[model samples]
Target: MRSEPLRFFAWNLGLPLAIALAIFAVFDLTSLDEIISNWLYYPNHEFPFGHNRLFENLTHRWPRIIPDLTGEAAIIGSILSFIWPLMKPGKHDRLLRLLEALRIAPLLRFTARYRRDFLFIVVSFAVITGMIHFFKSHTSIYCPVETTLYGGTMEKKEWFENFSLFHEAGPGRCWPGGHASGGFTMVALYFVARRHQWRHARAILYASTLLGAIYGTTRVLQGWHFMSHTFWAGVIVWISALLTALAFYGWRRLASPAVQAPGSAPPAPEQALSGLG
Candidate 1:
């Protein structure tokens, strides 16, 4: 069978392939072992622990939840990608328009008009920063546990010898992955925007949740973070989502003047498309 040139090249050597090589090179040259050992074993000082045990326990369970969720998302995304082209042309166009509305321009404008959405972003940033500070202050407490769970007890020089294939860059430090938080935040926004459409809203909610879970799981498996970190990240994201929803709804009522009732379907596809033009 004939193959498209771009597809053939991408199949053989793509951006991911190049990135993988660069990562391997960095791993070989850096004294990652020494860094991990010093960070995990050598305690510089002591600090009060603030992390809740119950929360940590819940976070730890995140590792178990991610794989199943990720598998389902993968299956769904695959099906969507395959079937999208086979959809009616009009349906496909509508889908495209829906996605276009999600572009940065609209999102930014929406956030600008709504102080609450902006506030939510600020709060999420503050929360993330606070978590980082906590990690630094209580470094001695968490690092040891992180090392024992994710990093094996090996000499600095032999660290790579026992390295797991799943290990990704930034292991130990990149715990409570930002990626998972970002994914969940997107999910929340989708939920608020499409709440009236039961089936569609549920699909998006499930997909977004799956994405967040998968991202967190991958980080843990790669030894980039502990299960606890990912869990807290998800919690923070959920909080951010609630704030974002409030901001959006409040702003819509204030800015538009006309308070349209909730649960209204969006304009018809042709009307929406014409409005866009």
Candidate 2:
């Protein structure tokens, strides 16, 4: 209700960050990771579920297309916004008459209206995925399957133990789950809806969270990653979305004026976030 930046940071970044820190700290002290990994693994230390056709198609393979299609669609819309007119029949050349032939005036109109939000979704997804990839490459933490617990060579190490000056012989790029992060990027839709003041924005946010959890869970079951890996991936996506939103749309948007309820008295001067200055 008051101080939008504070609220934004608390919900969008702070909470997930705090949970990640907790998982990071606590997971090191417990066998929770191995416990879950062991349950999913077979007696022969094999992870057959990781290679199952059902999981591969439903979880690993199909969900990936969402972000790819979303980014591609956003790019196409942005390009059309620039040339849809010339690309139409009336004022256009032969090759440029794609829009008219396709009869996408409705889509073009929506794109024109929410051009910024759509573009921001692409940017936010790119930034989140990029950051996750960078960290995954750098962290060098072994995934469950890659560990001795699941029949690999690398010894399980603690959080601090993994932070050595040099990585071991087989360094892992599995700490922040890549596929899970991709699933989490659905939150970008919430940002777009929020920018347009859509009433179902919160529903979008909740559903995206659930979708990310499902995505991350599949990876965990498959032994491709630990739970913390997926947990941190979501945190990274959420925080990246917040920063990207602020970067694409200013912090003032985060600090937009509070909505007044019917028959409610006017708010005090301090009710808002001071407009993020």
The Cα local distance difference test for each model comes to 0.43, 0.71
Which parts of model 1 are misplaced by more than 4 Å? 1-175, 195-199, 250-277
Q: Worst ten-residue run, lDDT, model 2?
A: 268-277
RMSD of each: 17.2, 7.9
For model 2, state the Cα shift of residue 11 in Å: 2.5
Per-residue accuracy of model 1 over 93-205 as CA lDDT, tens digit each: 77556656776333322322332333433444445445443432332223323444334452122223333333232333443455566455445434243423333665776
Per-residue accuracy of model 2 over 1-277 as CA lDDT, tens digit each: 5676687777767788888789877775788877877877866567657778986898888888887898888888766544333333444555434544777644654455455666787788789888886676566777787778787888776545554334332357787778888878989887766665667988988888888888888888888888877788888888888889878766655556234365654222232112112
Where is model 2 more than 4 Å wrong at Cα?
A: 42-44, 84-102, 158-160, 163-170, 255-277
Task: Tell me the RMSD of model 1 versus the true structure.
Answer: 17.2
lDDT of residue 10 for candidate 2: 78
Best by TM-score: 2
User: What number of backbone clashes does candidate 1 have, counting pairs of residues 3 or more apart or in separate chains?
Assistant: 2
Score every model by TM-score.
0.35, 0.79
